[model samples]
Target: MQALQSRLQQLENATGSDIWNILKGSESDLIQDLSTLNTLKEDKEKKGREALKVLETKKKELKSLKKEIETLRNEYKLHVEEVEKGLKASGLEMSQVTKVFEKVLEDSLSEKKTKILQIISSMRDFKTIPELHSPLKSILELLKDPNQEKLRSMIQIDLEDIHRQSMEIFRQNLWSEFQKQGIPMKKLQETPNPDEFLQRVSRIFEFSSDLDLLLIGIPNNRIHVAFGMLSNICIDMIENEKERDADFEWILTSAHKWAKNLREVIEKATERTGSEFDEKFVEFIGNITKRFLKKNQKDPLIFTKLATLLRRFEDTCEFNLTDKDIFESLYEPEFISKWILLEIELFTLSFNQLLLDSSSFDPLPSIFIGSASSSTWASEITVQFEQWISRVEKDISSIRNPEVQTTFYECLYALMIDLCSKIHVEANRLYSEASWSNHVYLVMNTIWELRRIVKVFIFITNRERDRRGKKKDIELAGELKWPRENSFLKEN
Candidate 1:
């Protein structure tokens, strides 16, 4: 029995040893798995930190680029503004210079050649006006001479003096201003052309204005003095026959420049007053137009100036034809007859100028007639008719004089009828002459439009008359009823 118990104990010991081995194996595997998990976590954290560092660096670079772009935009804006201001100032300076140049030309032309040369030489170290008077007196005496050759030679010599004196004065004035402002006059003088000089002067002027209103303090007398100088130059140009072509081109170019300068000055003045000028503004324009007409009467450029003046006054002119008074003054039957004749005369003039073959009325009709599909002129005419209709309707209630009202209505009716008939005849002629192209179709369509406009005018007139007649009938009936009631009361 004891031997059997020892064998059973040995079997129990073997089973315990197997279980301990299995437990140790399980513990080792668990430790290995935990170590692998810890290593992976450490690697992940390190990579995340490195990626964050890279993002921060990229963000800072983007910010730097943004700031640089903003700085560049600001710098560019300032540069452009500076450039524009300079251009405006240069224009003003050139105007003043031109005026002074003109005066010099006039003085030179009026004086004797040797005397003028002496005066110019004296001006080299000019200290006083008295120093110039001796030479000036001598030149005045030479003007009494009647010899053409002597006169011509004397004038040429005087012109050279004038050019020299004018240039010296311009240079001195420009140099003084440049020095005071700390601008480089030498650089400006080195500029190749007038345009370049103008640009530089403009820039300087803009800078000056920004620094202070240095240009605004000039006296009224000074402005007139400048104008006088320019006037003298213009006279010289007109009188001098030797430099006709060169002078003409110069005058034209200078006049254009002067006009531009005047416009800029006016604009600046108005801007200072918040873009509103007084009645003096109108007077100023009128003065300019008068001067332009007087100076350039026969020049083709006069047409351009006249057209501009008309445009300026277009908004203010009494062009509405519906008001009885306006219609009577502008387009009564007598006036209409005169105007139509005048238009015909003008049309004939245009035809003569074109040297058109008028044997067939084709050219004449083409000029007056417009297309329907793309005719801007037709559109304008249509709008004008519409405006007349509106004005008639608006003024109908205010019309007091029966004769005047009748005159307006009749004039309007006649005008519309005449225009429509003319268009219809022209359209018919065109259709007969040619197969209907887009242009012919447009002409036919315009005739139809004119017919519609005339019909509308007739309808408006009839409707207005009917309304007034009904109101009159109501008033008449009330009067009759009152009289009948009064008679019954008296009888009782």
Candidate 2:
């Protein structure tokens, strides 16, 4: 707007000048009016000729003043032209900038005011504006101070500082304000939220697309700052949204999609410097593992979820496939492999407790005499297994190597054996026919259920072995101790 006003004023000053038109015919007008003096008597025409002479002098002064103003106007026009070109080169849309500036600086505007307003016009769409130091500085430097440098100095802006402030504002405030129409307040950070989360999340990616289109050629130092700012904001927002009652793994899985959007923006903005940006998120992953580990010191099912969480990072973060596995996995392959190894250990530990619990090994006919309410021990164990294994199967999609998959299956096989052995011991201890049939039915049912689950471990491990061309000399079910029909006390 300021630019248009400046331009309109410039066009008016250039074309609406009657002084230039008068100057172009001044000599003829002066000659025609003074010609009567040549025909008159010398004494009588002298005063008229002197009056004409004085009028001609004033006209010459006006002409000189007009020329000087024209020169300044021409200089200002050249400056505006150059700035518009710079805007185009910088990938900023001049048409949009013009419209935006026209609306913003409509009242207080000048040709010199157009440049920064053009850069800042992007504010309507996003909080963060592209780096404006170069274009703004260049344009300001080109401008001639209208108030003898007083007003110019007062209005002098540090575009870098403004850029920083805009980004910080975004970081400090939650994005929910912009997304009020999106995720319902009741559903925020809750389950059945992926769909809503995705709607808001897609905007970040779309925001990324806009950043990629920026004509901003900020310095490498500025690029680093951008990446750092964005990375920190991502970590902070995702962390701040931690919902205590919601599923931990589910929140992280959803959070990772947003993080990936930030990552893509940083990668695009930083280019060669993206490694530093990419590595920063590794710290977030490491922190999640540490937090989960501290919380799971006594919880049995957490390791499976923890392992799953780490595996999610490994898949999305681009950890290498050939590297040796570790107890810590992340964007860093070494650490990621290490994390995976730790998860496998935790997985093994959890199952060992699940399957080898001595309480399940009690073998007595008295176990059948208790009311249905009194003997919920086996049902409780089965319920826990059902809740756990379903989650385990669903969340470990990040496991890349076939060997790692086999290790987990082997652990499951071992667990199946431990559980089956305990049930077998209990089944052999029943005395009377009614008690034996009743308790034995329960024990055999437990064994068969475990066997069916072991079959999955069998199918996975055997298939993996085939893919690797390993000798299929061993059977998964045989190793897991499939219940052979050796009658315990001849079913008596």
Candidate 3:
């Protein structure tokens, strides 16, 4: 319409006065069209008002209907409760009903009874079911027949008698086995070679004793007897070996191998040997440990022996076992795994004792233990530390054991055990976390370098590599882990 009006104006502008007169003549008709649109607008407003009133009336009806429905629902609920009460008063018990029977078979009592019996029969380890007694009593009472009171009493009496008789027989069998096999371990040292003796004892434990079952089973006197035998034998074999005391390395290596093998064999046996025997071999392990400690506690070289014994074992553990027969080697067939931790306990005790004995360290010159220079406590202990390392180097230099040479960690361990003892004492006495942090670092610095000093005697680590490379980088390998600067102040 706008386009038409614009075209008419363009015609008046181009064609002159006649087109302008015609456009003026159509203005009244345009006014009449606008008036007709206004009349239609009033009519639409009147119809919309009427529709809104009708919608409001319908909403009121819906609300009234909703109220009536809620009233009906409440009445239905009350009726359901009344019906349920009547049914319950007529001797119904929904609580006793099993969900399966109620849902699937419509609460069949016979089906529930069969299911309940299945549940009761499935329970094992009868002593564990004491908590179920009340429920069982309730179920039985529901199904009780007063007429069978005498029959039930008779069955209970018979069961009690049978249980008593069974237990008596079991006890007798245990005692009989104990009598035949629970004697002290026979002399395992017929041969000077310890391996054969170890094997013989292992055989006695395996075939005659059911040791795996015994270890998992109850421990009685027989178990103690077995442990006593193993302990006695282990300590004796090591302590009394021909020329073994002379060669400390050989004794340590043998101890390492035997302890590892024993632990392995015993672990494998106990893992799957789930027999119901009466006694555990772990207690025997404890006995072996006790005897070992008692026999060797007084030896001057006890700590070194204990340390060396475990050091070889620890070194062997660090290397990965790539061979398929590794387990077989450690836990060899028939020989029970020897307990290593027992010797480890002795080692720890010896170490702690060594730590507490300040006298073992050279006497510090007159001042406090923290100050060694100017005749202070520090100077004398440092002197002792040097002397101790010098002795260790001499000792390690004399090693004839090929195995000791082969495993260098054992050599390193030898250095650490004594070095750690000095540090342990000084750190506990002279330096603590609250007191003199820098001085603690000062003490630690000297202690750390002891390793480098010892390395010259037995350049066991990276010696070949350094020789092959032929460079000054060998110094890098020997550098001690110096204390970080944050905590330390060196005396100028």
Most TM-score-accurate candidate: 2
Q: What are the Cα lDDT values of the candidates?
A: 0.44, 0.48, 0.43
By lDDT, who's the top model here? 2
Candidate 1 has its poorest 10 consecutive residues by lDDT at 474-483
Model 1 alpha-carbon drift over 4 Å, by segment:
1-219, 235-253, 256-292, 295-446, 449-492
Q: Could you tell me every candidate's TM-score relative to the true structure?
A: 0.23, 0.36, 0.25
- Residue 55 lDDT in candidate 2: 100
Kindly list the per-residue Cα lDDT of model 3 for residues 25-72, writing each as its tens digit.
Answer: 666765766777788988999999999999999999999999999999
Q: How far is 15's C-alpha from truth in model 1 (Å)? A: 70
Q: After superposition, how far is residue 455 of candidate 1 from its true place, in Å?
A: 14
State the displacement of the C-alpha of residue 454, model 2, in Å, after optimal TM-score superposition: 1.9
- For model 1, residues 93-206, the per-residue Cα lDDT tens digits are 545656887777656565545564665566566533334334444444554455434554655555455434533444344344434432321333332553444554444333
